[model samples]
Target: MEHNLSKHISGKFNQDLENVRNHVLAMGGLVEQQLNSALDAVSANDSEQARQVEKDDYKVNAMEVSIDEECTRIIAKRQPAASDLRLVVAIAKTIADLERIGDEARRIAQVALDSFSKEQQDLLVMIDNMGRQVSKMLHDVLDAFARMDVEAAFKVHKEDAKVDREYEALIRQIMTYMMEDPRSIPKIMALVWSVRSLERIGDRCQNIAEYVIYFVKGKDIRHISQEDIEKDILKL
Candidate 1:
């Protein structure tokens, strides 16, 4: 959790950096709340709660724009170098992913607003379980980002594969459901899209994990395999 921000001579500069970092964490907290509420709506089948989640998405979007502007202002005014630059860059990227995660959460919430049959409810249960997995991943990655913990980031990075496996299995089961009951196609399509959104959220969490690694290690590890990350980056 400790960083080099205080090493700077100007106390104002240190405060500037600290302010931006805290804002990112606050934004992360809001995004986490949004995801949790969306999952709750799905599990409870509450259209009112789902609509509330939909309404709250604008808050997440606003935070992204505000943080982005702050980062730009820091770069222009402070002209930071080395680790400071990386921190700002990583944070800018992190907020973008978090906003997308918020969007996906809203999409997942939309599922509760639609009517599902008993069999479809079973599929939704599976989707809810998968969403819980992704939500945990998002939670862990955000914790990693807050601490600038590379090991924690790596751990969360590894969890995405489990989400992907669950996604594939659910897709197979859902596709079978669609093929057997063509009458349910319309509603089932919505479920399929929601599951897909959950999968995308998993990917975004992984991307944020990568940003954490980049910030701590000063390495751009995108498109690198997990084995390569552990072998080439993590070990160093």
Candidate 2:
């Protein structure tokens, strides 16, 4: 976490890097808000809040583009090397993941605009439970990013498995419902898509966590098993 960002000869260069990093954290906060609001909309059946989440997606997209442009500008102008370059790369990747998480939140919000049956309410409850876990994961990863806490990032990475299990179990439940009443397929499909989005958000959170580990440890841990990460890379 002890990044030498202030070591550059040009104070402006240091400030520029700090600004871009702060913007990424700001973007993360916005995405987290969108996710929480989307989940609340579905749970409370508030179309108004859902529509608001839909409307605010553009903000996330805009931040991504802006931060990307800034990062590009930094590389072009300052020609950052070593850890500074890694910082920029990590910010780029993190923002991309945050934007996609926003998209997933929007997808989840769409389910709120439509009505569900009494029986289908159970499925929505399942979705909400999974959504909350994913939301917590997202929040934790962002906090990890802000503090450059590698251990926190690893914790979030391991948490994705729980979300996956929840997603798989929900899918099976939905499939069973569809089998009981063929007529419920269309409605069940909507729930299917929402749950899938939640699962994907969990994945994006894991990706951000990887970026954190990469930034701090300068190690590329993608495609590596958690056991391997702990036993090999993290043990260092």
Candidate 3:
């Protein structure tokens, strides 16, 4: 038998869905703060700042858990359809991306702690720039989501190129250092992890941006290569 909700229950269900949206936005803010603090710690060479980043990791983790629980409750109790269902699904996915970004920030802090002596200013500069790019991507994607702006989301998808180029540059430098001085291999490896973590943060940001597009248009803009999206879809 198909279950039918009474009018009052349906209204309450809609309210519950809105709560999920709010919770997702809250989680996005927390992760973005962590990313900013991680960059600040790296740039400033402040151990105390790095420690603060580590401490804030729990807040992000908690947000992830809470959002996940809310999503489960909505799906079970509300059985929302159409856009409401889409919103809940998007919120769940966005929280996952934000949580992953938080994990990457924590990883960066750990890399800094392990790799820094007094300070590695050159490496710190690169990491700060990388974090900044990732932060901007996340911020714009979140804005795109709140507004349901597909164009803004697509822009984020394109902006990922800068992060990719930076990651490749870091890889080259790492390989060169390893080849020239075998003694630097251990430190170079640490740098490699830090840089890769930053790049993965960018990827998670892109993933969230795509979610905005999907929720708005219900398109699986993912897995469709850039060329296809531009030449195939946009052209049509």
**CA RMSD per model (angstroms):** 1.8, 1.9, 5.5
Stretches of model 2 off by over 4 angstroms after superposition: 1-12
The lDDT per prediction is 0.88, 0.91, 0.77
Kindly indicate the candidate among 2 and 3 with the higher lDDT.
2
Point out the worst 10-residue segment of candidate 1 by lDDT.
1-10
Please give, for residues 153-236, the per-residue lDDT of candidate 3 as tens digits.
778888888999999997887687678778777876767887898899889878887877666666678889887766754442
**Residue-by-residue lDDT tens digits, candidate 2, 1-236:** 43344552256588898899899999999999999999999999899999999999999999999999999999999998877888899999999999999999999998999998999899899899999999999999998888788888999999999999999999999999999999989877988999999999999999999998998888999999899999888873
Which residue pairs in candidate 1 have backbone atoms (N, alpha carbon, C) closer than 3 angstroms, thus clashing? Answer: none
**What is the overall TM-score of model 1 with all chains considered together?**
0.95
Looking at candidate 3, what is the lDDT of residue 3?
A: 13
Tell me the TM-score of each prediction against the true structure.
0.95, 0.95, 0.87
Ten-residue stretch with the least lDDT total in model 3: 1-10
lDDT of 2: 0.91
Q: What is the clash count of model 2?
A: 0
List residue ranges in candidate 3 displaced over 4 A.
1-12, 114-120, 230-236
Ranked by lDDT, top first? 2, 1, 3
Q: How many residue pairs clash in each candidate?
A: 0, 0, 0
lDDT of 3: 0.77
